[model samples]
Target chain A: MDEFYHLIDWALCLSGLIGLWFFFSRTGGPLNKAQAYMSVFREKGIYNPSYGLAIAFVYALLDIALSIVIYVWFYNDYWTDSDFGIAHLGRVILLYTIVLVSLHVFLPKIDNRHLRKTINTVDYHKMGLSMAAFVVVCVAVEYWLKRFVYGMWYGEESESILATVAVVASTAWIASSVYTSLNRYESIKNASERTLGALKTRHAPIVFLRSFVLDKPQRKGMTFDEYICSTFALNSQPIVSLSDPDDFLPTGGSIKIQSTDEEWESAINTLLMECRAVVIFEGKTVSLKTEMAKIQRFHIPHDKVFVATPPQNYRLAAWNDGKITERKYTLNYIWNDFVKALDTYGGMHGLPETDPGECMIFSFDKHWNCKAPVKKTGKDFLGYVVDQTVVHENDKCDYISLAEKLNRFELQHTQVLSKSDEKRIEKAIIKALIMSALMSLAVILLIKLLVK
Target chain B: MTPTDFQTIEESLGSLFFILVLIYYFTQLGRLRHRKKLDDTDGVKKVKKQMLWGIPVFIVLFFAMVLSSSLLL
Candidate 1:
């Protein structure tokens, strides 16, 4: 037994010494796996800082666990077996404070530009003080929790390792896991809010129309007032004739809901929010040149707009010093062009049928689950005859208003991740942390009580 | 067995447990790198491969130490 003990002890002692050598050197050696593992985390450090901090916290905590195990192993070798002094525990914790801070702070700061940006040259002392405070706290936990616990357990003639198992497994893992979860939760919340904000502030759609359309025949042969009723109704979509105050208003036009010349731009802004399609009749007396420019400025997608203008002798393109160029076409002309576009577009894509306007029926999630049972049939969402992401496919419902509350401040009428989604993720993170704590507790108990 | 022996065996087993975890985590990292087609950082690729090989060897060695200590009369 003495010979075997000496043999195995010599081997472990040699390997441990080598591992220490490799670790301190930070060379391409056995410790490279550790370095590689860290670099993987470092790669993600910039774009998602909170997630990166979570990784760092986890890695530091795990390293400390491994260090504790190694410390216990070495205690018997360096000191009298299992009769370690408080000074030795202090020394070990002091070493961890140095090593963990180096890895977590200094190492990241050295190479990562993102980490470097955290400190201005002038604020180095302040940052240094904060970092020192953090390290002091970490070392205190390592020292007090392990050393003091070991003292009590040792007094009962229990092994010193029992204390380490308790501290490293239960206390350390739980604290680190909870911290990581909170960091990730804050990150996701901020990210979700930023995305939703961008969506809300976006410019809405606009439709251009001629005043003649309100008073003229509804369609090619129908005579109803276009405002009260229209011909060739597309799923009963109203041909809302949005007008400018500058346009020549023939009598009997629909401006019972009208604005004056001073409020014309404001009126267009209002229409930009609500108008779906514009049908401008290209006659001798009407034009929507400013409204067209506003539509261009808002970046309204072409599919949302259709223009109708009379055929001209020759198309003209604007030019200035080889830089300025634009094709001048009336909204009415664009309407005819849009029909051509629909033909070419539908021939290749088989779409425009599934186009979502102001609202939708069943949401993407619901549509997916409902359609996926047939498996491959619903791959093309447009091909599905039913409109999704709404209640009962009601376009008139103004689903955005009646939409489910996403969080305290907003509603989700579309497929973008809502605050509720973020909350669900946060809850999952908490559940995972709790499960990890429970598992760590179980293992700590098993290890500490196993000797009995 | 002496308390000293228990301590030695426990240390070996504890080290084995930690190493097992490291191996599992490193394996996950390796899988992640491959899945994401990640480029290797300085010395990481070589060390990762070496560690992958070295861990199992260490695992076996630690297991032997624990088993032999546990069986000693």
Candidate 2:
């Protein structure tokens, strides 16, 4: 019993003495030395003291644990026989207190967040090597302290150690197995939900055209008027073409339909809501009644749709309350181009509303470049310059609509910057300075106490 | 035990320590490789940086022990 008390006292005394030595030694050493070493990797940046203290704590814990284990196994018997008392124990505890207090004060002020970030950007192999180095150093130091300064031994606990090793191995294996099983189950469940959701959203447009073949030919090849009528007959969608009554009227080519006033109103309303756009193919002479009336009924705004009505070269009388709508400019080639384009894309089986936006129109030309709007901004748009001047038809109007959608005001704002790094650096520097000063003070105090 | 015997024990212990460290290292490597998420480059760098200080301290202690018994005696 006496020997046991002696050993405890001796350990306490030795611990205190060592703690005092550590306090003094640090004061003489360079301050914020870790920050200097870290700076070599960075041009200029702050070092974080909290991060450094965390690392230091981990090392200290490992050191203390291994040292205690070694002492218990090898030095306990010898230690018991040594002569030590309460005064020694008190000194040891005091020394340790000062060291701890110093560390607490000094550890918060070093700044090195940028250096840490830079180091993190590197490859894994380099990182692994660095960690391995720390483990080696920690273990090696513990072994050395046990073998030399303490004259300790591992003793004959080989069997117990073997059992511990087995337990560790088994624990790791079990953890991995459980983790993998859980992950697989979660991923499979998520994938199933996604697939079901996608299926619910898929839809295809309804097609109404019926198949037919030309049977008997009356005049070998039908004239343009006859060709147009036959094509219209095959269209599945309900379409009514309004032609000029006075221009190029084939005497017997007129067709008639019978419908109630209510039916006509409902049809017009439905057409306005669903039909994307109308193609008004102009001719040599124009009758304004049926086409103009339909356009007004639909209330389809001018920008919402396009009229393939290229202005004629010659001035013609316009009837707005029976007077001519004053004419400004005329381009003959543009009118011919508009007529040709309408005949091509607007032939009879015009595509039903494919997407929500609008119906597209195009005309091919063998000569010079074509002008078309590429990007839309409200009323105006950026024109796509294909081959310096010729813009492709469908590609032109689509670009404008896309630009308008993208130009929403909220999307134009600049992004805010992050200040976490700067804040972190400032915190680290303050911590480091305080820690350094506290440690220095503690070390000076301890040295003074020891000599006394 | 005689100084010679102490040396033998120390040498054996040192070798055992080395072997233990090597095994632990290999185990860590296996763990990192087998991890579901691959090793993060930043984590590796951080570990390496810590080791720089940790390893040298360990090496000093290890060599000091080996020398203490034989030379200090």
Q: What is the TM-score of each candidate against the true structure?
A: 0.24, 0.21
Residue A256 displacement in candidate 2 (angstroms): 63
- DockQ of each candidate's interface versus the true one? 0.03, 0.01
Q: Against the true structure, whose DockQ is highest?
A: 1
Name the regions of candidate 2 deviating beyond 4 angstroms. Answer: A1-54, A57-78, A81-120, A147-149, A154-452, B1-73
Alpha-carbon error at A67 in model 2, in Å? 6.8
lDDT of 2 by residue, A1-452 (tens): 34544654565566556555545443311122222223321333222222333333353343344345334443434243122122223333443444444444433333222101011222333333443344345445544554455543344578446644654454344333323322332322222112111222111111111001111111213322233334332122122221121111111111211112224333333333433333343332222223334444555443323332211211121101111212221123223433343334322122221111111222222321222312222112111111222221222122223223222311121211137755654464455445544554454456445644
lDDT of each: 0.36, 0.32
Once fitted onto the true fold, the runs of candidate 1 whose alpha carbons sit more than 4 angstroms away are: A1-12, A20-46, A54-132, A152-425, A448-450, B1-73
In model 2 chain B, where is the ten-residue run with the lowest total lDDT? B31-40
